[model samples]
Target: MNNAVTIVRVSLNDANTLLELSRKTFFDAFLSTNNPADMEAYASTAFTLPKFQFELINPNSAFYFALVDNEIAGYIKLNYVDAQTELQDPDALEIERIYVLNDFQGQQIGKQLINLAIQTAVDKNLKYIWLGVWEHNTKAIKFYRSKGFEQFGSHPFMLGSDKQTDILMKKEL
Candidate 1:
């Protein structure tokens, strides 16, 4: 692929597209490692258009789409302050979600999306960037570590009815 990847800030108008991309990327990443019923249950509440609309308009939350040849290849969601799922630290930003389409993996799309998140935190004078990754997601854990993130803690995560642990990792700016 040519180096035509562009990152654009998402808005309410992209809700439908975001919904579909979110569902597709999410399932593509986790379907094989998770129970189908559990995945369906989580997607039922997480992948709805209405939910996307609500998240899209949140002042403390932001979303960006990584496009290649004008087609979305990935997306990232960020949360600040009270919008953060757990830490809620005023001096930090939370990377709530970052996923690249299966067809677009290994093209540095995920790396670029993460670099954007890190720059955003730096631009805002945030002290650090943080995120949660499933303990079972070793590939993601390694990726984060390579990006200068280190595990500082962990928390329980609910994927449908399955209670799992998420390693909380952070990169200090």
Candidate 2:
């Protein structure tokens, strides 16, 4: 792949594309280590058209698609203020989701997406950026740590009926 990557802000009209990519990337990332029933249940509800539509239109939430050579290779979701899943800090930005296609891993696509998120937060004068990663995802935790994010807390995440722990990490700007 060439070094021709671009991050495009997702719009309402891109709901269908976003939904499909969201489901595909989420499944590729977690399906292997998770229960099939739980994965299916979560995907059915979380990756639907209506859900994407709502998120796409939400004023405090933003989504972006990372395109490599004009093909969607990854995506990121950011939530601000009340739209944040946990701490509703107006001065903070929450990275609710960041996923890169399995085929696109080890290509720095994830890092590029993260840089975009950091730029976005800085542009808004946000105090800090925070995110939740599954505790068992050591790779992701290491990545976040490399970006200067420190573990601050943890919260329970529901993957369908299964409750799991997500380590909260944050980077102070």
Candidate 3:
């Protein structure tokens, strides 16, 4: 397991690195999808630098970068959404995205990124953290559960042509 991971808030100036790392991490994580078309659709947004730049300007969002030996290992995004709408949270925090390179999956970088997101919310005086993970993504659901999240509900996750069911998980801090 890697013990050299560091968490930092991604800055607006790091736009290029953030976009490139996001693409690397996202593609590696989802490249094995059942549909190639879905993968392509995902890649469109995952690789969009301009969109990331726009997101960086959003004050309500928090983006954390995981670095291992000073290199980008993964990233996670957190945003304030309605907890009452998705899960059991009295207050809401949506884990917008969590991406880690496939080669770094077992190194706990994802864990670090997630914890950072949760901590960020807690720091902002938020009461609960929530996220949606595809039902077919067994590993991700398992990881969320291990982190004290529980299945609050399920909904459709829009992939390219098929909308897969996704489990909405939540945890109170």
Cα-based TM-score, every candidate:
0.97, 0.97, 0.87
List where candidate 1 sits over 4 angstroms from the true fold: none
What would you estimate as the lDDT of candidate 3?
0.78
Deviation (Å) of 22 in candidate 2: 0.6
Ranking by TM-score: 1, 2, 3
Q: Residues 1-173, candidate 2, lDDT per residue (tens digit)?
A: 55778999999999999998888888888989999999999899888888889989999999999998789999999999999998899999999999999988889989999999899999999999999999999999999998999999999999999999999999999
Give, for candidate 3, the lowest lDDT window spanning 10 residues. 81-90
Return the number of clashes found in candidate 3: 0
Give the better candidate number (1 or 2) by lDDT: 1
Report how far residue 133 has shifted in candidate 2, in Å: 0.4
Residue-level error in angstroms, candidate 2, position 53: 0.3
Q: Which candidate is the best by lDDT?
A: 1
Per-residue error for 23 in candidate 2, Å, reads 0.6
Candidate 1 C-alpha lDDT tens digits along 1-173: 55778999999999999999999988999999999898999999989998889999999999999999898999999999999999799999999999999888888999999999999999999999999999999988999998999999999988899999999999999
Which ten contiguous residues of candidate 1 have the minimum total lDDT? 1-10
lDDT of 3 by residue, 30-65 (tens): 667757788778678656888888778777666888
